[model samples]
Target: MNKDSTQTALLWIVAAGFFMQALDTTIVNTALPSIAHSLGVRPLVMQWAIVAYTLTMATLTPASGWLADRFGTRRVYFTAILIFVLGSVCCASSHTLGQLVIARVLQGIGGSMLLPIGRLAVLRSVSGEQYVSALAMISVAGQVGPIVGPTLGGWFVEAISWHWIFLINVPIGVVGLFAVHRYLPRATSTAAPRFDLTGCALLSLCMIAFSLAVDAPSQSHRAAWSTGLFALGLVSALAYVPYARSRRNPLFKLSLFREPNFSVGLIGNLVCRIGSSAVPFLVPLLLQLQLGYAPLQSGLMMLPAALSGTLAKRWIAPLIRRFGYDTFLLVNTLIVGGSIVAFALITPSTPAIVAIVVLIVFGAANSMQFAAMNSVTLKGLSHEDAGGGNSLFSMVQMLAMGLGVSISGTLVKLFSDQWGSAIFGFRMSFVCVGGITLVAALIFRQIKETPPAIASPAKPAVAGGR
Candidate 1:
């Protein structure tokens, strides 16, 4: 085959990896209740399934680049597919929540490697001019995943069984394994940086401690356990700063935070995502558990948001050019947060039209917010620091997502018993999460000077995994 044809084939192979990873993120959300029932666990307590996958991904993603550099990209990418497929098989075979969470961690490990390695393969194979279009093509798979994942997962559960939701990855992975081996070029970085084992350990432990604390079972000793975990997590995370400062080649440079916009944007992304990330997880539950919607029906209801988010991409550059990042983010953050809060108004008697409108509005604002915030965050980085900055930004994005679900789940669990109903619990959960997001808008105000916005549409930073 010609070079162009070879590159085209390589792009598709990588896209398959992107699609599988993105699909798994949303697919399981709609199936949470069904999976919980099958495992004989309470639906409310099943947030661990989502948390485990996302947290593992966040914890492991920083290592992907080094692995691809040390081992060849083709070999690493192939192994990722293999491991992901094995994880899926394990998930389908799981009989208990513990088994499922363990399977998800395995899946997350594979997922953490897939996208970065695939992207590396593309960069190594393609020329500079071709890079943008190549990445755009791969990103389409990411976009389509969220669009169809929930609905597809719902259909699998309702028509067949929840296990099919996981088993579906088997065929895709099989094909990916074959295509990657054939089409991807082999390459390795000549000067791969030393692995930051200590930094990785500290950050991973901190994330686990915090997530476990937040998701701790609501019991007589809950407060004590949560407090200890929170303190440990905070201290461990803070310790990374000093460690990074002392090391000549740390995992991430502490100096990256000196840029005002970068600092503020990072904080804003984490805080805002913590509030908004709960929407995808919450919407399906509200529709199925509170109202009378079936799993498939609830999944389909997500279409409005997904569709509008796609369409909203075109509007981002124009808006950023006009209002600039500072003004745009300030106003848009409220819209996103308020839209989340609006879900509290949803009830059985609420008109479907009203809910659809709300979803569309929220989708558009959130999409714009993602594009703006990501651009601002990375836009300030010097070329030397861009890769590490981008990697850390993506890590925080996933971490916040897992944290969001834990926060939302714990709130719902707490209020359900307090208010004596799941509906009220959900309502209060939305309000609290929304309030957290609204407060996050204040952090954005710290961006005193606006940075130049990029002309390209930014990919939606994955929240909680998706």
Candidate 2:
């Protein structure tokens, strides 16, 4: 193939991988209730199915770049798709909650590598001038996935069996595997540095421990175990500080935190996302269980948010240039938080138009928040620090997502148990998570205002993992 043809083929290959990953992220949300019923478990308890996938992705994502460097991208990317397909098969075959969670973990292992490695491949293949444009094309695939995922999942569940959700990936992935083998350049592997095994383990353990600590009260009602896990997580996090200082090449340099915006952005992303991340998980459940909507109807309701979010992306760069990151993030953070809190008012008696307006507002604000937050976080990094900094940022993003679901599920379980009302539980969960999001506005306050620079084409926001 000609050089142009090769690049074109590569773009499609990567975009397909991204589409699969992004599609899986949101598609499961609308299907959770059905999956729970099929597996003989309560819908609220199904957070593990989601949490397991996200947490596994979080645990392994830091290693993706290294694995790609040590092994070739073509090899790694192909294997990722294979594992993802196998995992999907397992998921479709699962007959119990535990089985499904395990399958999700397997799926996440593949998902963890897809975007990062695909991005890396494009970076290496394309020239600097083409890099941004290439990424923009790939990102469109990510966007399309969420827009269609919930509705597609709903349709599959309603018209066919829920197993079709997983089965749908089979043909797409099989085609992807062939395209990868035929078209992807076999980039030569580099002499990679020794990975920070200790640092990676400590960080992974911290994420898992904290997530389990949050989830334990809901799962086992074991306060002592939860407390112990929380303590362990805290200790592990602290331990990484000294360990990184001692290592020649830590998983992430502690100095990355020295950048003011990066630090604030990281912290803000973690705290703010904890609330907003729960919405996709909770909203479908709310629509179906509390409002008595069918799965297809509930999925259709998400169209407003998904469409508004995509449309809102074009407004982010101009808004940031006008308002500056500090102002934009501070005000938008509150808007996002307030929108989340507003979800509490969406009872059956609420007009459908009212719900749609609220979703549009939240979707737009949340989309802007992600673009500003991700750009500001990475913008300040030195060229040397950019790769590691981005990897760490991605890790925090996934961890926060897992934490969000864990925390939200625990809240719902606690409130419902105490109030003996599921709808009331959903209401209070929205309020509590929304309050958690509002706290990030205070974190954004720490951002130092800078003069606006000329606007550039926006890089794709991190996948919302909806």
Candidate 3:
């Protein structure tokens, strides 16, 4: 067979791993109400299951690149799969919210490595010319999982049971194990950097403390611990800046912030995501919680968003080519923010057709944002900086996903309590989320209008894996 086919196979395998990891994150968000009922917890208070996983992943992500660089990529990649499956089994069997949270931590520990290691494998295996295409392919797969996860999770809950949501991962894990064994290149760097344990500990503490503190009201009733954790988290995260300055190499790597485009892009992604990311979680909650929609109806309502996002990928490149990153992000950020505002207008009496159209537009615009921001962030990096920069970027993405939800939930709770109306709470939340997006558009405005820098031009097709 030819090189392109072999490389395509490898990319697909890597993308499969990514899809599994991302799918788990979003799938559980929608199924939380069902799972909470089974586990005997309040649906409003189940964010910890989500936060624990995301926080653990954020803490562990910095170390993944180092692990893959030291150990072979295939070794670490397979290890992640094994750990994730074990975590899933534990999660499926949990009888209490606490047990599920612990299990999710284990799952996050494993999930932290999946995308970075898989992407590392692809980067090391392919020629420089193929890096953008390879990454684009993987990004597309990663994107699809997030889109379908909610609807699929709801379907599973409605059709079978919540436990099956995790059980399904078993077969996919088995498949990934074999794919990695057969097709993955086992590679390691010769000059491995020393592991920075101190930095790692500080960052881990930062993530864990902040995450638990934020989710504390919803988790256990430990108000004191929540305050203490939030304090510790701030200190832990802040301490790293100076430590990174003093040391030769720090775990989180401060050098990445030096690039203006990257800095702004990362912030925009995190803040804007506060609006976009919470919707998937909140939409399902709204359906089951206030509207009393059945799981099946909720899932069906969700289909328009996911599918339209997938379809919208076709237009992203041309949009980027036409408007450039600055204009594209600015105009589209407003579009995204406005679509979210439209959700505030939703009432029980709102037509299903109107809701579906709104969701489709929101999902498409959100997908465009993902493709644009992600591409813009990494597009300028040199080969030497790509490894560390991308790893940090990924960490920020996960961290913000967790934090955004935490912050939004907190805001919603505060507003809901004051107004004494759940619908008012949701309305304010949507407006607040849109306001954040509008603010993010200003960040992208800082970027000069230039074509995004891709690694290398694509070559004519040839046969065999490089």
Candidate 4:
């Protein structure tokens, strides 16, 4: 095969890896209740199963580039697939929530590497002119995963079992392992810089502590310990900034923040995503808990969000081109926030048709929000700058996911307590999570202007991949 054909094959392989990672992460959200019942735990606490994986992703993402630079993407990528497959096996066999959380951590150790290393492989192999096309191609998997995940997981739980949800990953990961080994290239290290073990350890501790604190139960007797852990997390996280700024070969280079767009984009991506990301978590509960829907039905309700999100990605660039980045982000953020608040109005009496319509709009807007923000944030990054920026952005994305889930779980708990009714429980949760999105709209005010379109030569597929 020609070089271009070989590279395209690599892109597809890496994209599949990313899709599996994202699908496995989201597919479980709807399956949580079933898993909870089987394991005999409160469904609310099952968020840790997800929290552990995302927290590990946030912690390990910083080391991705450094590892690739040290060992070679080919080796690291294979190891990641192996570890993920092992984790999946363990997850399928898990007997308890505690065991499940540990399995997620093991799953995380494998998953945390997929996107960055795969993207790095693409970044090294592709031309600068095609970077946008490559990124857009890979990001399409992320969007599609959500659309398919819940439905697929639900089907598995219904026709087979929840264990099948994890068992499913094994075959996909197996194919990925073989494909990556054959297609991935070894990066020739010119004089290697020393890896910063100290900084990596410190950051890992900070991320772990912070994520645990976020996931901690609000009314649990362990609340005080959660507070202390969060405080320690903050101190360690803060300590990394100056220490990174001082070192030549720091694990995370603080200097990446020097570019205004990259800096604002990363932060803005995290904040904007918190509210939007939490919706997938909140909506299923509102359906299953409040509306008394079955696991299969609740999971099916997520279809519109996925479908509309896929469809809406096509219009994002044109909309941004017309309104400019600042204007598009501001307005879209409001729409996404308003849509979240709108969920508070959903009830059993609202009529199933009306409810589906509302969710479709919400999914479309949220999908647009993701596509718009990702393109805007990445629009200005240079080729050399892409590695660290991409790594940082990926880390922040996963971090926000954990935080968003934590916040959603906490709000539901807090609201349920305040109102003493499950109906009001979800109602209050909707308002708070929606309000968080509205508050984040202020962050975009910092963006100064938009850049000229650096259009790709090859057209990437739209959100739904059609």
Candidate 5:
């Protein structure tokens, strides 16, 4: 294959990895009830399956880049697919919630690596000119998974069984394993840096503690455990600063923060995502629980946002080129946050057209924000810092989603109990989450007028037997 064709083929393979990971993320959400019924557990109690997957992913994300460097990207990426497929089979064969949760943890181990490593590969594979569009294209494919996942999961449960939700992964994963080996170039370091075991443990503890703390409110009514865990997470995070400073080689170099755009962009990404991420979890519940829509219908309602997001990728490059990242992100952040607030107005009496428009606007703005933030964050890093920086960014992204869900769920519960109305609880949750998103604009404002220049090219790769 020619260079252009080789690049295209590589991207599609990476997208397949993304699709498998993204599909699993949302697909299981819709099937939870059916799976619970089969396993003889309350649907509410099955949340562990989701939590275990996300928490495990967040905990293990810091290690992906190191593993890819120590091994080779092709070998690691292919192995990730194999592990994810095996976990899916385990999930399908499970007869208890405990077993499913364990299987989900196994899946998370692989799922965590898919996007970050695939992205690192793309960053290494493409030129500066192709970078934005390449990432956007990959984002488009990843977006497609969420678009189809819920609707497909619901249909499978109704027409077949919840087991099909996982079984569907087997065929796609089988294809991916071969495609990865065929198309992806080898990426490995001759002298990989020594693993930062101490820093890794500390960071992992911090993520786990924080995630479990926030998630506790949703799973149980106890405040003491939640508060304690939150404190422990905070301390663990603070502890990392000192360890990183004293250590010769830290998991993530503190000097990464010296890059202005990266620091501001990273903070903006985390805070903004925490607020916006809740929409996926909240919107479907609002549709089914309050609006009395069926699971399939609720899933279908997500289409407008997903489709708009897919189309919105094309708009990002021009906007950033014209307005610049600092200005574009600052203005667009509000739009994203405001759109979240707009959901509060969505009721059964609300016009379908109005609700769809809200979703589309939110989706478009959110997609742009993500593409821009990711570029700005990674663009500033030195080539040597790339692996650690990418891992940290990925960790924050996963943890933010978990935080978003936990915060939204807690708020809804609080307001629902206070008002004795479920709809009112949802409205309040939207407002609160949106407000938190809006605050992220202040963080984005700290970005400088110009983006930092890329300092070096990523390591070389071979495609089409180059």
Candidate 6:
């Protein structure tokens, strides 16, 4: 193939991998109830499956860059696909919830590396001038994945079986494996710096412990265990502070937090996302389990949110330009949080049109929120610190996602048990998560307004904002 052809092929290969990863993220939410039925578990309790995958990704994502550089990108990318495909097969064959959760962990291991490694490959292969455009094309694939994921997952569950949602990845992975081997460049390996294994382990443990603590309520006889895990997570997080401070080359520098916007943005991203992230997981359950909608109908209901989010991207730059980051994020965070709270009003008798309008509003606000949040969080980092800051930011994004689902599931179970009504439980969960988001708006208030010229370049709307 010619040079252009190679680059084009490489782009498609990476885009396909990104699509597969992004697809699996949202697709499984729609299929959760079906899978729960097959596994003889409650749909709400099945969040461990989601939590395991996301938390595993969060745990491993920090290491992907080092792994790619240490090993060749093509080799690591190929292995990632293989592991992901193998994990997908395991997921399809799971006979129990335990088995499914284990498989998801395996899948998360691979899913975690797909995008980061693929992006690294693109960065090494493409020229500086084309880098942004190349990433833009690949990001389009990521965006399209979530747009179709829920609906496709629902269609598969209704039309065939839930397993097909995972089975679909097999063929894509098989083709990708060959294409990656053939098309991806084998960049010369450089001696990578010694990885901060201790720091990474400590941070990963903190995230795992915290996530498990949030998830503990869903499991029977785990109150004591939950308290212990929360304590462990806290200790581990605190331990990292002194450890990183002492280390010559920590996994992430403590100095990164000194950037006022970075600190504010990062915390706001985690807190605000906790509420918004729960929406995707909770909405499908609301439609199918409560409203008596079919799987396909529930999935189709998500289209308004997805489409509106896409349309809202264009407005982010201009809005940030006009109002600046502080005001944009402040106002938009409330809109996003308010939209989530509005979901509490969506009972069976609620008009479908009203629900659709809410989804549209939530989608637009949430999209702008992500674009603005990401830009502000990243804009303050110096060129030297940008790479580490981004990696840390990405890790937090995944952690927040897992934390959101874990908290939402726990809240649902708690409220339902207390009130003896699933609908009320769902309503309370929405209100609580929305309240959590509302609180984050105060964090965004810390951001100092910058002139339009000084604002960071807008990032493409990240799929699911992670």
What are the candidates' C-alpha RMSDs?
1.9, 1.7, 4.3, 3.1, 4.4, 1.7
Better of 4 and 5 by TM-score: 4
> In order, what lDDT does every prediction score?
0.87, 0.88, 0.78, 0.79, 0.80, 0.89
Residue pairs of candidate 2 with colliding backbone atoms: none
Over all chains combined, what TM-score does candidate 5 have? 0.86
Question: Of models 1 and 5, which has the larger lDDT?
Answer: 1
Worst 10 residues of 5 by lDDT: 457-466
> Going through the candidates in order, what is the number of backbone clashes in each?
0, 0, 4, 0, 0, 0
TM-score of each: 0.97, 0.97, 0.89, 0.91, 0.86, 0.97
Tens-digit lDDT track for model 2 on 161-238? 889888888999999999999999987789999998999999999999999989865455598899999999999999
Cα deviation in Å at residue 420, candidate 5? 2.9
Please give the TM-score that candidate 4 achieves against the real structure: 0.91
Pick the winner on TM-score between candidates 1 and 5.
1
Worst 10 residues of 2 by lDDT: 452-461
As for lDDT, the candidate ahead, 4 or 5, is: 5
TM-score of 3: 0.89
- Judging by lDDT, tell me the better candidate of 1 and 6: 6
What is the C-alpha lDDT profile of model 4 across 411-442, one tens digit per residue? 78767767787778778777887888887678
Clashing pairs in 6: none
Preferred candidate (TM-score higher): 1 or 4: 1
Candidate 1, number of clashes? 0
Worst lDDT window (10 residues) for model 1? 457-466
Q: Which stretches of candidate 4 lie over 4 Å from their true place?
A: 1-5, 126-136, 186-191, 218-221, 381-384, 452-466
